[model samples]
Target chain A: MRTNLMMTAAAGAILATGMTTAAMADGHATDLTLCWAAWDPANSLIELSKDFEEQSGHTMNFEFVPWTSFADRMLNELNSGGQLCDLMIGDSQWIGGGAENGHYVKLNDFFDANGITMDDFLPATVTGYAEWPKNTPNYYALPAYADVVGWTYRKDWFERPELQVEFMDTYGRALDVPANLAELKDIAEFFQGRDIDGTTVYGAAIYTERGSEGITMGVTNVLYNYGFEYENPDQPYDIDGFVNSAGAVEGLQFYKDLYDVGTPPGSSNWYMGENIDAYRSGQVAMQMNFAFIWPGVEADENVGGGNSGYFPNPAGPAGQFAQLGGQGISVVAYSEKQDAALEYIQWFAQPEVQQRWWDLGGASALRAVVEDPDFATSQPYAQTFLDSMAIVKDFWAEPAYADLLIPMQERMHNFVIAGDGTAQEALDGLVRDWIEVFEDEGKI
Target chain B: MTYSPIDRAAAKTPDGVARRIRGLSDRTIAWIFVAPTIFLLLAVNIFPLIWTIRLSFTNFRVNRPNNAVEWVGLRNYERILTDPDVWNTMQATAHFLIWTITLQVLIGFTLAYLINKKFRGNDLWTTIIVFPMMLSPAVVGNFWTFLYQPQIGLFNYVVAFFTGVDPASFSMIGDVHLAPWAIVIADTWMWTPFVMLICLAGLRSIPDSIYEAAECDRASKWRQFWTITIPMALPFLMLAVLFRGIENFKMFDLVVQLTGGGPGNTTTLTSIDLKREAFEKWRTGYSSAYAVILFVTVFGLASIYVKALNKVKER
Candidate 1:
């Protein structure tokens, strides 16, 4: 009986300690879980969240997954009712389906209540990723990281007077940054198989990953520049013309031609990692990638410090265009801590915090912060990226966008790697498959 | 009444013992012994299988779980059956299975036969021959990928020296026609040693009396090999084929690392395609059907092969 009484006393003490700790953490609404792509930038965001924690007095947990598994992981977490995350950084392409499926917390009321206006963000960033439809009032998320397609080139190679003279003599123009696809191809061909600085280098490197989003990201630049649209303006999935349009075929053919003459052998199997390695190793004269790679290119001794230059994707006959590639912070609709998650977003959206984010090599989504001279001067390529952010166009903002993208990616990889079919044939096949997906989903 | 109590106590002892003995039937006792195992099987195997079978008939997407699940009946199965791309993938898988199993059996048997003869360093030779199977498949796949690299890869360097073709011009993974063969070759290289070990065990189990009897009969070495050794090892060889066939049918990790089912789905086996659908596309119900088909095919084939192996053993 004495031992039992002592055990009861010990249990009481333990329960009291637990209750006290809970009370300490309980004043603020609840705990919030945030998910994002695992990378150095993600680490920086985690470091920056300490101030939010102090001010809000709410505990925040983070779940970081690799880019390859980010979407699938988030979807599974939400589906399983697993309480895996309260807030997530989702790919832009996922916003439509995510909103339609009710995975995201509708943020319009929260924005209104907080006196937060979406106009405070870059218009393209806001509409492209955060809004459900173009310029729609039903916002499902807030733009967290705004990225767009851009190109990096070897400035040192282009500046060589002798090479410039030879290039001009061969192409009948002074060698400069390409203003169009034709010029880009000409520059690529000129530098192909050239021995520079006692090392052999190729002209360009592009991703051709058969699985995941590699091909989509790489091919969209050409597709959009050549006026490829996912659907008709009047009807969904009625892409008979835009998908297999003559200009789009020309664009695909141009990519294939560039691969044939300018890319290093085995380039067809390259992905993002390969692109980064090739550029860092100085084996390629140019690389087309998103803004996320800028910091890596700038910091890496082999590619960044003094050897790199950035440019917007060259214009095509139709118009100047770049594919929008960015991520947004969405609160999981199933989260028990919705209020705390919203408070975190509000805290994160503050201009002062965003400026600190910029100082830490983060891409800012706020127009006010991004336009600040102080933020622009934080890094060398910040202003360049801020300028390019103006012209970005996102493809397929519908719920069935992922389904439409799969067949397109497969066909693109087939065209580039196997050369099994003409660009027109591949694009026509994509149009058929995409229409099927849309029809099945009742989106058309 | 006093006398009845004493008699009742005497009857009770033997009656109680007999009742206890009769209560434990052989089947009941046996079940009691295996109850834990039976419970485990139900928990781990039967539950998931029933769940998956149910899921296979529904239209479910991982991303849109809250949406209503529609019953598609056999729609997924019919689509898989008629799809040309799926058929092509099956053909690739069959080609890989046939080539790798044939190569592994032939080479493994030869190695085992040679090692069975008591020569200098015979034990050492046996250990060295089985080393490849001991390493992880992922490690083997990564190493072989390096060796197949077109420019600086050792295989390409050696081939280049003989053929004078630019090593960098050809890609093993990028070529649709060559990617499947690359996977088959790597699998055969790693697994042949397993077949060799099985063959070695079979060879050892055959008594020296048979060879001695053949010698007494004045049979030639070739005659003895054909009449005695081959017959004795047939059962083990068939067993090896059964094991290897079932394994190669579901081949995934090595091929995923090597070619990633790329070059336009040319090297995509059914397993790779199923993974792409289920995980990558989040089409859970569709891929569940795909998985069920794969399961049935493998299970059906393995059952027939096992029966044949039993027949061989009986002979």
Candidate 2:
């Protein structure tokens, strides 16, 4: 009887200690770490996060890696179950891996408890960035940025009378924003090796970067419009015809043609940064890049003002589509300060905060902000951003996305840049590679 | 009793500790001294190697820890060996290895021979030659990209000057045919001095008496070079080859920063390919198998080379 009484008291004391610790934790301030790629938007986020810091009385630390190494570094951190990041703005392609590997906290319940609705966000952003099974209501993250592949052109040069007349005489069309990929090609060809202000300029700076995801991101913008589907709509993983369709081959060839006859010399391995440099330095008349660079181009001394114009990727034979490029913010499963991280998400999802995010150079995915009546006229590229997002298609968001991506990068680079094999052969090889991957994954 | 500082220090210890120390055997004391190093080796080196070998037969992914692991003996090895792309990468590596070694050795030996002539500004020339070696491989890779740039690059301009070709017509890193050579040239430029220093050491170690004796025997300079210098420095030359061969086989950063294994895998060395498999693809077990194959190839070749080196030394 005495032993039982002592045991009960000990248990009660332990319970009291637990409650006290929990209460103390809830009352105390936390140092939350948010990880993302170091870019202009990340800087804007830093400025915006200061408000959250003051409101919550919690410190916010940022770990921003460069675009090239961000995935490798951050993914490694997540896979190792490192507690470095309480919040992560991970790439969209990582959604499947993040959810499957339990690197991200499932936000469905969190959203319910916090009155955060996915309906308030853009459908494409939700589908691309938040949902793992894609289009399913199952949520792993909240859409943080809305970005898509878009074009920036030398509007000043396009408006020039001599160039316009010459372009019209050559292509038999007004040199305006290309209504289609064919017209875009004509523009690119017309601008190739043209003299502008005593400097020889090239047509465009397209992504041909071999490392990481640059080329894949660039090529897919063409591929999707040319009827390159990831899989058959009726049958998941049935991609033989869909991936290597005749239209897809044409798309691949078109991209290769643009690469060969359009881009500047030594642009065989260009990416976003390289393209930006090419455009800013007047080496190229047009640049294909993500919409996020629009603001930077608008602010640049050389390419800024009304000199540059933005447009969504022009239509192709099959349809109009752009490659999606954005990330979603999620609470890392390994984080100890998940409550604080969730609070931050709740605060970020507010309409007012999202409006401020847009104002501060963030590509806010909130429909409440983007769908506002004044949003289209907010910035010169705002309408282009909207159009691009509407037509955005993303790469495979499978758990094996890296495997899928690496092969595509190799095949695309080999065919397009290395001048190896035919376009059909390249796409066929990719099909075989992806099939093997799917077989290994037991998804075939 | 008179004692050393260590002994005095030991003597100041508590009686129980002192007694225990005195009770230990010489072997135990030796083991006590070596235990930490042994433990470290086991933990850092031997353990991982053994673990890697064990993992080679399984289908385990590091990123998908929740997934079930399955044993698939020799499958990864078979796939790697039979894959044409793998073979292509191997060919690229071979091309890199052969060219870099041959070029570095030839140029290095020549430079070392010239420097050993002990002319004016010899130290200055040697220091200048070694500057490229002193810089980080990553830095060399980065700057060389600029140098190899098509239009504004000094290298392209120099080539154009010699060949009378347009400066902007060809891209060293952007063309498949030239990308391999681009990495080779950059690597040779950066690492040639390392080989030079080794050859210089070897050259310096040879005594003047040997040359004097050769001259006394009515041997010509060419004969002395072929007979005395070549034979004497064979081991060092072999040593330099062995080091450079191994280093070039695992070359990653310099080439990666230069071409990123492109113009479509023209410069994709096995190290870069293995990195893609291991980290980017997260195929841990498959990459472990890949690593094992590489380790065995390197070990077997190095063993043969070392045997030859020992024989040369004996001669």
Once superposed on the true structure, which residue ranges of model 1 sit more than 4 Å away at CA? Answer: A1-32, A57-60, A374-378, B1-22, B119-129
What are the lDDT scores of the predictions, listed in order?
A: 0.81, 0.92
The worst-scoring run of ten residues by lDDT in candidate 2 chain B lies at B2-11
A113-227, model 2: which lDDT tens digit per residue? 8678999899999999999799898999999988999999999999999988888888888999999998888889889888888998999999999989999999999999999
Residues A1-444 of candidate 1: C-alpha lDDT, one tens digit per residue: 335435644554454344335535776435678998887678878888876665566676889988766766776776566677889888888788778888888899999987678898898988887888667788888888888888888887888999999998999998888989889888888888789888778888876777667877877788778877766788756889978888889888887887788776666667667788788888889988788888989998777776788888888888878888888898888888887788778777766666667777678898767766566666767776876797788877677666777777778888877787899999999888887777767766
Best by DockQ: 2
Docking class of 1: acceptable
Number of colliding residue pairs in each model = 0, 0
By TM-score, who's the top model here? 2
DockQ of each: 0.45, 0.76
TM match of model 1 to true structure: 0.90
Off by over 4 Å in 2: A1-27, B1-19
All candidates' TM-scores? Answer: 0.90, 0.95
Error of 2 at A23 (Å): 11
Q: Which ten residues in a row have the lowest lDDT in candidate 1 chain A?
A: A11-20
The candidate that wins on lDDT is 2
Global Cα lDDT for candidate 1: 0.81
Give chain B TM-scores in order: 0.90, 0.95
